[model samples]
Target: MLISVIIPCYNSEKTIAEVVSLVIEEIGKMKGYESEIILVNDFSSDNTFDVIRDLCDKYSSVKGIDLTRNFGQHNVLMTALHYTKGDIIVGMDDDLQTHPSQIPILVRKLNEGYDLVYGKYPKKKQSFFRNLGSKFNDFTVRKLLKKPKGLVASSFWAARKLVRDEVIKCKNYNVHLQGLFLRTTKRICNVDIEHRERKVGKSGYTLRKLLRLWASCINFSIVPLRLSMLVGFIFASLGIISSLIIVIRKLVFNNIYLGWSSIMAALFLFFGVVLMVLGLIGEYIGRIFLCINNQPQFVIREMINVEEE
Candidate 1:
């Protein structure tokens, strides 16, 4: 079984080189399965590409993929998955937080017949709000996608090559990797592993970005959409009931009075609800347009100094 260790890099210069070295040193102990380390530089404005190139020159099994621009961590991982030629593939971030030492644990779990083995953290050492928000996202994902109730970290996981292929074939291009795992594979297990705070540099995921991810997770659910339709129906019903009350008040009870403020307020509230529904519809439409475009998830503008043996 060939093992491909795929790490996606985006300006991870501070700690990236150490991660590469650690994976190379640790994976060298495993026998029979040839190992390949694929580092994809996501157009790092820093010296990320240069570091990858240097590593490639130093190690025969090390390879580098240079994307044209930053296509996000998930997109680059998928791109590497497309190019992976391994019996079993392991994926992780270039950040040191997802330790390379745990790769063997995940791979061993995969070998025990599980299609997917994720490395859940012992305790995430993120800021309070980040941790809280991430937990909320995970909660919604579990409720909506019916994914396993595992403490899933977006950091490390291993899967059989077939699982990789199935996930890649998914049509949804928003590219939530863990969700794709749930969507494609039935045999999934998460093992508790070491989780370290970032040794250097701030996290790429900000509060806004986490919330956006939360939105995507919820957006993918039928329940939110069903709820939207339910709310719309309620709103429509309310509008009808309100109009009836106004007419009855004026014609039968003579209690209707002209108050421009109330009328304008109702109009604004109704229109606001309409606009919100439209916004949700627009999000789905935008995703559809992106798929129709069928653009490459990550464009490798150039590969640098690649050599085997």
Candidate 2:
């Protein structure tokens, strides 16, 4: 069986070569399994692609892709999935955090009749902020994307070819791999693994990028829109009830004072809720417009050791 390992490279010129070497070494020990490495340079502002090209030249099974722009990691992964020819697909980070040594554990777990296997870290080796962002992301995935409770999701994961085929069918510009995987199959499992410290630069995800990724959850579910509707209904019900109470107070106690200040406050509160609901609706519409316009999920700048399809 052929196992394809996909890594989305950012500013990782210092560590990608060693990552490829270790992956090759690990797969070399699996007697019946061969390996193919797919390195995607996500428009890194460094010599990351150069290193990828060199790795492609050195290994016959290695392929490199250069994106026209820094499509997010999930988009780059989607692009790489299009070119994989392996029976099993594995995704890991360009940084050594998702270490190559743990690849076998994910692959072995994948072989246990599971469509997808995620390498969940027993203890993540990320900064406090990054870990916090990860927790937020995990919570959102479980609630919005309907991921199975207690099933951890991470960058290091392995999946069958069928899962890859199903996932690549998603042409939405907002590519959330966890959401996509949840939509594809429920046969997902997690294997505990060690998360190594970064050997190069820090993570590419900033606060803004993390929030943008969280917003991408809208692509897979309408829970947000539903929540907006629910909120509107609750507020409307409160408004009606409050109106009735005011009427009763005014009729029974003619001296009851409904202050202008309270009226202004209620107006401000309701208007704020209305504007927020409108903004959420606009977001949904904007994404639909982009998709209807056939926006490209990713544009490939170049390829090395990759066959023309």
- Leading candidate by lDDT: 2
- The TM-scores of all predictions, comma-separated, are 0.88, 0.97
Model 2 per-residue lDDT at 117? 97
Best candidate according to TM-score? 2
Worst 10 residues of 1 by lDDT: 300-309
Q: What global local distance difference test value does model 1 have?
A: 0.80
C-alpha RMSD between model 1 and the true structure: 2.9
Number of clashes in model 2? 0
How far in Å is the alpha carbon of 148 misplaced in model 1?
2.9
lDDT by residue (96-183, candidate 1, tens digit) is 8888888888988888899988898879878888777778878888888888676474668888998988977865557777677777
- RMSD list, candidates in order: 2.9, 1.1
User: Model 2, residue 292: displacement in angstroms?
Assistant: 0.9
